[model samples]
Target: MTKETIQKTNPDKIDSILSDYILHDKLHQAVMISAPWGTGKTWYIQKKFIPSFESQHKKTWGVIYVSLFGITNFKELDDIIYHQFLDFYLSKSIHKKIPSKAIRFGETALSIVFANKLGLSSEDEMNKALKLIPQPDHIVYILDDIERSGLNLGELFGYVNNLCEHENSRVILVANESQILGRFNDTHKDKDKNNSVNTENIVTDEEKRIEAYYSAKEKTVGLTIKFQAAPDEVFEQVLNKVVDKREVQNLIRQEKNFILDLFTCSSNNDTETILNLRVLAFIDVTIADLYDSVKQYLDVFGKDNSFNDCLPSMINTAKNKIILDMVRYTALECFKFKMGKNLDGQSFSYLGSSNHYIYFLHIFPFVQRYIKQRIMNQDAVANYLKIVLKEEMVNQRLTKSVFPILNEWWLMNDLKVEKAIEQLEREEIPEGVGPEYIRGMMITLITLRERGFSIPIQHFTDKIIKYLNSMDKISFNNSAFSIVSIFANKDFIDLYNRTMKPVYDYVSQRLLDASLVEYRFLIDLQWDEEFPIKCRNHIASFSSDRRFLSIVSAEKISDKLKNANPGEIWYFCKGIREVYNISNVSDFYRADYETVDLVCKVIRDLIQQYEKHSLNKVKTSNLKMLLNLLDQTREKME
Candidate 1:
């Protein structure tokens, strides 16, 4: 088998068993290969079984493969088998030397003549005409997706029995036997309740269907083999097939083991193994897309080597974190896409809990958007990652130029200390700089003063407070104190609480209250088409205060909802649901509960008002749904 081909389970054993059955010319029964869904059974059979058979018994067997998926009737099954048989026989015929174009032209001409004179335009008529062609001998038939067929199991197995016993054709059946049995039990639970084979027979209809199925299998299916495949081998084959960019491919290849383990191993001792190849394909694509975004982030901000120089070990840890988080996120998305549900607690142990904001990847809004919508928004991702890296540097007490000096302050000479003090004095805090930079400067000055360096620590604190008080607007809020506590050491925390906390809180609160223009713009967008995007951006913004609901105007929102069109109202309510859902986990949105009750009341009133107007039924129904959603959100909050 090629490296790019998915590896079959116990290939040599299967090959030997199948070879024995095929080489025995007088076929009496069909062989069944059984496995769970998405285990690469179909791939292995096509890529492995067919080639081995053709190589070893080319003249002794004629193989015809047919998928029984969605085959509702015997006629449909017959048509498919007939077509496959025609292709297999023609490929081995003397007419194979004839160009396919001439063969197709002759067939089309024959079809036209039959349609006009012989009335063979209908499918049954066409089938009757085609059956006149000579049949090929020594046929080996592969019937796949047997469980997926719409035909009844008893009738389907009977057909296969006839093909094996009467026609003397070798047959291979591929299916998930458990699924077949499960489907039988489910559909036949009450079938023919009054009918009984005998008076002593108290069997349910489900038991009857199962008995009939097994009886047919006993006559037709000679042997059954369980299929299995190594997930790593299958994943590698899929990686080689789907991923195009070599660098991205190599990046994913590094995490092949962890990714496979996530699917195959259950943390809660659950016996079921997913080992889904389709989910693996999605994961490979997700990781490749996210890896590109990570590359772009590095390209944008990697040139500033000072942070790297100061903390190489931390930098390496963070880099490794980026790759692992990418895989974790991809695994989660793939599971949800393929399984149609979120991960359970058992999976959370491996994939990382979304409630934990300590991991930057789990909460990054743009990355979440990319995973769900498949729209990268590269600029947003790059910008978000840049802030995340900066936060990492700040939390580790290493900024661009300031932290290096203070980190090694004791080893530095007097001139260096003076230069560092001068840099802090003259440096203008940028418009969007985090509190960590300000906190870092304060911590450095406090350290200098404690060391008897004659540093004016109080002077710098006064200067910063005055500067912050004089600003026309400030985006930082009281919640920023949480960030301060995160990055602060014992001494800085003491000094900040004792001296700076009250004054900083008053000034920051004033600035936060003053910075209402952005919030107003966002609230006004409830009538615009861009409400959803703007609302998400508002929540995800680093500088903007997310505690808008604590201060938001319910009357204003209700008034706008009254005037907006259906699409705008949908977007508005969608944005509201997003905020309420996010509020369930985000501390930043905890204060939102103070006003959400009022918003819920407004939604209920709107629902009732829209109910009166027959023209606004869509709006009324949507409002009712939104009210129910709000009720659920409130329950979660309680």
Candidate 2:
């Protein structure tokens, strides 16, 4: 028999965690916190922990937060600490005079800056100000972004050591330890392991230097606490900064779990991909900035665009800032006006070469528009890539993989039979596309088929059938793709009805197994607070054709029709309407055709009588029925 224990980290309880770490300390010396970048090392301390400690009404004078990034020397560090110390004193509500010796130095320099008196040197004054700050137990010093600092390592560590031992200072060093260790070799060639970083594993001088640096850090930092912030909390805060929390929440409500599912599925448990804080922040801002514009465009013209490989490919790109930047770059090129001018070209300017940035932007949007316009030839793709980039930039192997990938993405985004036919008409389409690729595209087709696109995919469908037969069933029901871009376009729906219908049936059944299926039941069910998720399209799969949401003369119908209160009228008819009347749901059909149009007109008359509203308002009949139904149903249910 064996006993096992597992620990799941709760970012919400970070305050409690910090309390344990901080209160456990007896050293009154430096306490270092080490966390990977984007784990919210600085945010957690400044926002949550320090405020909490301050709120306790204990002996804590004030906290001074300083980021050491870009600090070039000891003098620069001294200046920052001196100003922060002064700011700390000034933060108090009550006015307090500086000590006599400090008054001239602190006030004179501060006034010079505020008054815009440029020519004066604040150097001697700043040094004097630094000496006056009490380096004792009255304040907490938060030193962060230390890994990026340009200050000499020995001198920096020496200053920290002297502060604790003689000045009675309490320091909290927040940094990424692995990152700082990596920088040590780059900066000090003397300790560069036998002149090569690759030889680091052999007991070399570089390894010794690394060990010595760790030893020095451990000595300077009396206690080390691993720090990580809750990604969810940080995401919420980041999103809330851009849009109202309720709106953002509503936008992703259904897909929130799906986005996380996408994240987990794509990462394959790679810690860097799954837990990277920077990526979390990037996604937050991306959704904030891109959601409304992309959504608006897609909603009106969305039939024309989809984020094919881009959405799932998010995981692959999250590992590098450059890859993430590529997404932003492409979006900016297309929708620059909406993007705001904050970027000012600085992000791209930092990249060593403009070729990668310029070429990717041109190629990315070209691919999206190319697929949307239904140009399916591999040669077309190759020629298009050539037009977009220089000759050397086109990697043939990459383009080969990318061409099919673009095709697969096409299926995911916008797969009307009209567009698909261009690609599907090849003498042997399967020869150019992969089984995995085809499987993914078929799942996209199954989704559009369910949503009511009357595509004639079943006639002579051996091309699709042969590919599907080779694989186990594709489960689209729970996929993120299954939840996006559903529409009621009868002109494009096949509804899984055709000669090759069995395959569609098998795939359809698999996908609809979890959805709210029956039109009557789906309607009659009470709307819970969480019912009708906001962002996700909960696509309906119907079991009937002449579903009655009709408004007609109250006279000719059965007594059952007249006796109906709005409760019975709306229940069973909310989403019920004739999309098309063909026996085969997927048959070549359009709602505007004679039979479909006539049925819709007749039904509209029936529904109008139920409401007793004027025919002039026929356009609002369906909506009126639902509103009246809700009013009456609430009365009935309550």
Candidate 3:
């Protein structure tokens, strides 16, 4: 029998087990060590447990370490165990060719010989091998990350039981119990109850199986040791190594209390803390991905638009950034909670219940502070917020309609809400939204537009009307409302109309030219009528000068008409069809074929001229059809 020394940070437990094995003349072969990841499981085993056992037992006791990761099935399990056994027996300096089967057979035979050689000869060599060596005899095997191994847990337990019962050998399985318990429970439930007769029989079977395993192998004990996160004292020791300042260490200690509060308030169990840390690590990876994506976008698009502009260019872009940031913030908060710190005490600030408000508030303050600091110090803080709020009124209108949706999604997950409220409290802000709140309004608007929401202009215009009506009820002094109103005033509205008119005219002309103007577009236009009319009459009357058209077409009307098509010549002409369908332009639809043909000819000619240089690689069929349609209309004009 082998006498092993137990060297561990927590050596009392180890000594107790060793004492048990020595007094009973048996090896405690099967043991399960459970702990979470990053808990020093591997360090304890490699540095202390294995060395202490090997040093004390010497020639009698052998130690083997096996990692059970990437072994998803039972077949891999056999190969892994066999390989570990072989590696343990073969000297590190001896790199000679040794087949796995030879190693397996050698382990069995060598144990028998070694038992006899050690003066433990009793009955047969194999029987002697089964007996523990020296006083308290045991061999130790260390299994790491057993849960991640993807092995059949029940089958693994069965094998271990066999080794303990048959050979008087001990087996140790180390894993994160939180990760493995579900799988272990499921696997155990699938076992056939009737296979073992009774509970006592089952226990006896396991013991016998273990004994038989050791009889063939040698006298070995498995010690399973679970390492947990260090206590406050140990954590302080670790922190002292990482951080130099005593003040920072004290701050960390104080913050740990806040973190503990977050954990206790939000997490369902201790396992959640581990999961949260893993998630935070993932979020760090995602932040890197987002930064790379922004870098690439800037590289391709030029530095004229800053990183923040990438969000507001499209709804999709904005949504992606918001979602990514939210996830990242949540993960970061989770990490803080796990580490026993509050995120509110960190860099994050919570806005009121409105997500849109939060989104703008979070980003705007950073932008404002950055700009202020840079301007004051001549530093190079990029003005991204300037780009986002390039036209303040338009931005305000967009934000007011969109912020509710973000707030709704923010509150979807209970954990998110709890964390958000805690963060808000830290920020000294009110907790959640009030009643009668419009949830996900912006998301609805964006989705509607993407799904062929023909009336974004009208939808936005109507929302403006409602907003204006609600002005009396809404307190403009509120930070969120104040920020929004700053961008939605008359001058801002005028600028937005001026900036957007060209896009609208371009779309309208495409519709008229195609003879596809419809009622929906007209109705949508009605909502915009008040704004455009107000702008044109009071602020600026936009001239429908042909000079702007000249940039689109340089040739004569006749020359342009000569190159028209029958079906569709312009991409914008297709837009006309959609506009007409959406707007239900009855008169335009019911116009005489000659008038329609003439309109088509004019529009087709204009589109062709505009696209002439651009359509160098256009399909031949499309160009020819466009030309034919133009020619037919010109004949009518003549």
lDDT of 2 at 192: 54
lDDT of 3 at 610: 52
Candidate 2 structure quality by residue, lDDT tens digits, 187-228:
533335464544443334777768767656655666566654
**TM-score for each candidate, following the candidate numbering:** 0.54, 0.42, 0.37
Mark the regions of model 2 whose C-alpha exceeds 4 Å error after superposition: 1-14, 90-135, 186-204, 245-248, 261-278, 288-638
Candidate maximizing TM-score = 1
CA-lDDT, candidates in order: 0.62, 0.44, 0.40
Worst 10 residues of 1 by lDDT: 351-360
Compose the digit string of candidate 1's lDDT tens values, residues 601-628. 9878777776666558877777777668
Residue 198, model 3: Cα distance from true site in angstroms: 20
lDDT of 3 by residue, 365-473 (tens): 2322222232211122124423332323233334323333334543456554444333322331111221112212332333333334332444443443344344333
CA shift at 400, candidate 2, in angstroms? Answer: 35
Tell me the lDDT of model 3 at 623. 47
lDDT of 3 at 139: 50
In model 1, the runs with Cα more than 4 Å from the true position are: 1-12, 24-27, 96-137, 185-209, 266-274, 304-317, 343-363, 394-638
